[model samples]
Target: MSKVDVQLADVSISPVQYQAQLLAALQMRDLDKFTQLLDHCRVDAFSSVLESACREADCAQFVQQLLQHGADPNILNPVLLQTPLHITAELGCYETLQVLLCDDKINVDALDWLGNTALHYAAQNKDQDTVLALLEHGSYIGSRNHAGDMPVSDIEPETLEKFLNTRLKMPNDESLLFKYDFLVPPVALDSALLKNKLSDEKDNVIKKLSSPSPEMDPIVQISLSSKQQHLLLHPIISSFVHLKWQHVQKFYYYNLAFYVFFVLLVTFIILHHHITAIDEHRKSCWLNLSAVCFFKIIMITLLAICCFCLIFKLLFQVCISPVQYLHKWSTYPQLVLTLLTINVLFIDSGTGDSAVTVITLFLAWTRLLLLTGEHPAISICFHMFQKISCTFLKHLAWYSLLIIAFSLSFYALFHDSKAYIAEKNVSSKLFHNPLISFFTTVSMFVGGFETKFLPFETASGTSHIIFIMFMFFLTLVLLNMFTGLAVSHVQNVQSKSELVRLTAEVNAVFDIEKLVLGNPVCIHMWMRRLNLSHNAVIVGIFKSFVYLWLSFSWLQCFRNIHHSVLLFPDSSFDYANIVYPFGNSVNVTWNYRLDHKVLLQAANIVQKKNDEARQQLDCWAVFESYEERLNNIEASQLRCEALQQEILQLLRLR
Candidate 1:
């Protein structure tokens, strides 16, 4: 009827013209010319061919042939500019897509003329199998068409099941829909696009899946458990109290300032009122005593607060890092309560009759010791011995000054006189008068003894008048010197006492386990090692003895206690034996010299041992196995022995 359509050389006849010709070939399953004509025909000319294929219901094979021949499934018609794949999918021809996607050349990701991919059209057709076919080929699942419908989301459960059945026939693709089982809703799809760049990787899929479920992490689980434990151990109100201690230092200073002002003002008022009714001498002493006591309390309270704050902060910082169940005992609430109770129980009354007051004072001193982080025994002894040479020189200077002064005063008393009797009388006054002797002795003890060398008296006049004036002037100077020394001594004592207290506290907090994790802090562990806790007092008595020795020698000039015993930067000369001159001199007459030699020999042995130990440590760092370790040790020991033998041979030759 079509003028007897000619048969080609391949023995396949052109069955029908135009759309019908293409459809007949597709129905007959003649893939050869079907592929060729698909290549020759323009997309515009192929529109009716697709429609005819759909009508024949042999569209699946036709679609596959078109794609194999390089037909763009995404290409629009010349008139409508729409793709055949979208049109077929919209018509619910699910088989067509399965065949189309199998070709692997068609862009499953491509949109149609209506801006709808095959997936979009499939949702409109309510055909889940077609949707999945496009999805498996890396389709933009959940993407909107021109009509704004998300076909992926619109896919019904039954339709999805059907699609999944067909999907089993296809190779697994790393698409968002393949990775996540749930259909990505339209709202979520947009949000996910903004936040995360979806990668086609398994690890990325796992990470994304876990992002919304943090409880799956073991560390997070541990943290949650620890939080519950913390809650069980610490009451809510107590935790609030603990947090307050975080800023205790600020509050401590504020309270200290206010307390000092209040206490001093009250003490001053009381003293002023009492002084008017009491004798001058008694009034002055009482006023001084009251002021000292009041000030001491304020200082101690502030020091206690500081120590508590530091300890609590340290405990919390470490505990929080490991997500530990923070104990109530370690918390600020308990620490503050304990500290307050100690203060109340030990603090003495204003009249100094209360045991509570004494205890509180002692605790305050302890707090100050911790705050200073200095060791009383070690620092005190060190400073005392450290100053021996300087102290001795100072004393020597005073002694020379005193001798010159005594000689000059004698000369002035008798130089122009007819008799030595008048001179003897003046000189006797220098030694006999309590005021003169006191001033002169004090000056001689200090380097200030030089002023006594001045000649204030003469043989011509009565020496008593000149002697009195000299003594008066000397008294003023000596009094000022005593006041300065006393004040400095008090400050030094306070500092040392505080150090001792801190050392004790340090000892309390020193745990071998904690030390292994980190060094002991806040507490002076080094100082504590050198201290002795006995009865109610932990005395660095050795430090005191050393101080007494240095005070009497030429070494009192150097005053820093803590760093005193440390080796001097240069260390060219030995200063340890130089401090206690009198003691060393006396000891040298006995077996002390032998003891000193033995000590030196022991120190040398220790140094040699330390060097060996360091060598071993270095070797261990490099060598891994036990056999290697043993070899290294043997080699090092042999070398050391050979070196020692060589040194011995040299010494013998010398």
Candidate 2:
């Protein structure tokens, strides 16, 4: 056909005809014809034709040509929602698959009409190369298809064994390097060397900056400031946003210890204050006063530290997003504790020791239990309790209103009755008071009132019948209804235990992120310094002396008593030589030092790795910000272009 005839013929043909011609050209491997047909076809027609080509054998070059011409690799089949990647994977077209997989825009795990990913189809057919290609491109092996089967589940036994044995090699292709930058493995360092290097660097910096140095370079000063900023901000980033699992677990243990100590110290202070109030003789004693003063100082110091940490955390949350900060359940507890601690500091104990302060202390202790929501069993129980309590309270509110109305009417009717007045015992008179009457009636729902104390015993016959009806409705009907509702809610909670636990755990993690990680000063940093200090040696010696003295004093007191008992273990392991089941024994004296050193080295390695991961994540976050900005600019440009076109149309009409 002549060029004019070819162009006219393409225009005159239906969509099916064009698709057939394009497919024929693709299958024949006629690049020139394929290129011509693509030029005359629309994107939808070209996509359908390209998908058909993927299904045919040895059409890899045609697929490449289509892709190079800007044909989409992700276009779905109209019926199956299958992309060319999925089709090629299913048909075992390895060459075509390779071309499609190389395209960054192609989704390696794209699902079809059956919700089967490309990997799913490949695994089903036992297509080894296609499966490897998909996996290399980051396809998820655990994803369930429509039939609820994982890709691995579809493979034959032999193929499954092979897959299990296969070790996925990291992609080293230069083209894919940028795609996997975030997955870059951190550089490993010798644990002992890393610690020494870090300490030496810090000491050198401190020594150089201790005095004014006119010779210090401006670049060096900026670098030092940047390093300090990174060290200060790394914990917040790692715990809150990135939430690396290992780092989270480490922080959890650290915070758990600190929180437990805080709770115990607070409890001790509360009990001591109560004891001093009751025992004036003990309060007057020198030892008692000194102990109280010492404990008070420790409690105040701990409270101050916690308040300082909380202030920084609050500021960080508010700075990040005020609305989200307020919405979090954990924020309220911290805010209350902060306010209460500040209030307690300013107000005298004599003036401030009211029910409110007591309640605040209780709340502070209860908040500690919330941290245990990270445990699945604790989280499930918490969810069930929350659900049941909410349901019961809602029903109770309505039940209370109805019961209160009836109680009020009964009080009005019987207030002046001679029989009621004559039966004015302490319990009987409670119903005469309005507030007490409401509670009394509520108590009746739980069968709290005796038959002799019932309002009907003193009222008129008509009032007696009304009272019976009210009791039946409130106690029998509404109470049972409330119980049933709570039971239903409990069942629902049980069914969704996993989901609820996950949500609770996530919230707990976020709370920890805010409270622990968001602290301006890292507690672990001070702990490490304290552990390496000479003063720690002196403190340890003093602690040992005090413990020994207390034990001796306790033993002396027991000897003075007529009745005393002590239990000793029947079996104990010898410390000199530790024996194993294999009859191998190591001299504890020699192995103790070696084992301790090895443990210290291992700990240092883990700490170093975590620090490196945090640094890498910070770098990745910076790149992500740049990427987001570029996307915004592209979107803005498209919007501006459309507006410009609209303005041009309006001007032409005018």
Candidate 3:
């Protein structure tokens, strides 16, 4: 049963007395005293409901009692001029709001100082029920707040349309209709549509959007300003990037598999041919290949095949973007290592070419880290390594001055002192060169401690003070300071690691795109390759033979990939039928006076949905042109009529 909100019999009571009684009843939840005061001015029903609401499910009217008593529900908070209902909806006080909305006298459309109505707050907070309730009670749909944002601007249009129409009765206000009158411009006399409009708009948009240009990408540039470049990690955009990476990463894996097997073969060759050298200087050496056996020749042939595959991969990548490939850290390392491995094929010299191969082998294994760094989970550590190493290198130049200064001073102080330089001592050897002292100082900074490899027998008191000071400054202060800064930086980077991973993902994706859809050169190359093989009988047969040879079980991952397919050829995606799914159920009446949002496409998603929406986007341009043509024809007709009327008037006068 519905309980009375308030029933104050005494009309003789002052507004101050009623306001004081109302605040007390709401705060204390004492319905007996409140009802005693309200009937004689009492609040007993209000207190019982407020207190019992927790234990009982069917408690009638807590705040609903206060509303019945003419306790103003529209009371503004003074700061924002927001009423109780505005706060309730904004803070998501659903239970109290139900009670408040039951009393119709509560002003649902009350505006704050920012001119935001209760509906604006409800929509912003994403309170669907409050938004519907306010809309049902006639909240203005087209009302722009002081920020020039309507309620729809904050809330999703899909959600509002889904809930509002099915639930609430349509309001009578013109603003509630939300129909926009899209104005088309009047016609120019010239035939602009034939050629002029091509240069004007469409061509420029295609140019800006066709390539991997940074001009259109918004959040992708979010990390550009940051110290460590990171991509904006939105759910939709990140997923798109991940899918894009999947399309292109198989080539890298193919090349990586070949390189990995090649390194393993190099390992086997090193072990089989290695020997302890009789030379005093060299401890170990590779045995010369004087007796080449059948198994050895097969291993060599396998190595040659791996080398051929890798060289082809390198050439393919380099030709796609020569300048980028040459300069890239990823490409140049692989190239240098491959060249070193090739050197062993020519030179049979003992220990030299095998030594080169050993270095390449070390790099080949280490390079696995770089290859795997493209992955999102692992990229963070590599990014952190890069950022931290960069921090060290940039600061190392400055710190080198201190090491040099200390080294030179130490050398100058005791270089020629007969007492300090013992015949068999390391100091005698080290003090002979300032360069040795500088290098030793640097080594000591990392590995060892103290200035002495030996005790100073007869150094000055000034030298002793200097030695203590150098140790204190370099080891204690400087080292700890570097540690603190690095620790702090690590902590800072930890917070932004997710963003770093996303940017690395974007970087990895675009690296693949640079060979396919993104670069002008790559796209041209794609089209060129397609044209060469494009339905040509001989070329198709050659490609078929090549693919047949490559159709090994191991190459399954790369079998689906081909150059012609990389161009992302147009498919039967029906763009012409692209239409808004909701037909008449939605009504979003827009005032023409509001400020328009400037941006268009999300550049990261870039034209993937162009098949779905491209024609519809271009339709507005054609419609405008058609409208202008009609206007021009109508205007000419009016002028011709006026001329004929003038001629008739002249004939009548004669």
lDDT of each: 0.42, 0.55, 0.53
Off by over 4 Å in 2: 1-30, 33-63, 66-100, 103-136, 139-247, 268-289, 320-323, 348-350, 414-428, 449-451, 455-458, 491-654
Comparing 1 and 3 on lDDT, the stronger one = 3
Q: On a 0 to 100 scale, what is the lDDT of residue 592 in model 2?
A: 23
Model 3 TM: 0.45
Q: What are the RMSDs of all candidates, in order?
A: 37.5, 26.4, 30.3
Worst 10-residue lDDT window, candidate 2: 563-572
- Per TM-score, the best of the predicted structures is 3
lDDT of candidate 3 over 1-654, digit per residue (tens) = 223444546767754576566457645767666555545443442332332232222223545555665446666665666676776777666776677677767666566656667778888988887777766555544444454455755554445444322321113221122111100001111111112222344343233223322111222333343521322443233433443455556655664676667878766655545653455323222244334545665776787777777788787677556766787777778888778666665453235655676787687777776777767678878877777788887777798898888888767776665323345543344555798767766776775634545336557676787677777888898788778777877887799886777777667655654554334433222322332243666645644533343344474454333332131222111210111112224221211121111011122122333443678868988999999999999999999999999999999999
Which candidate should be chosen as best, given lDDT against the real structure? 2
- Residue-level lDDT of model 2, residues 562-654, one tens digit each, is 111000011111211121111123122212212233223323434565577799999899989999999999999999999999999999999
Stretches of candidate 3 off by over 4 Å are 1-231, 246-252, 267-296, 348-350, 353-362, 414-428, 449-452, 513-654
lDDT (0-100) at residue 493 of candidate 2? 80
Instruction: Please report the TM-score between candidate 2 and the true structure.
Output: 0.45
| Cα lDDT tens digits for candidate 1, 73-178 | 5555565445666666777766775665666555554554344666777766666667666665656544454444445455554554443333211121211011
Candidate 2, residue 198: the lDDT equals: 32
The candidate with the higher TM-score, 1 or 3, is 3
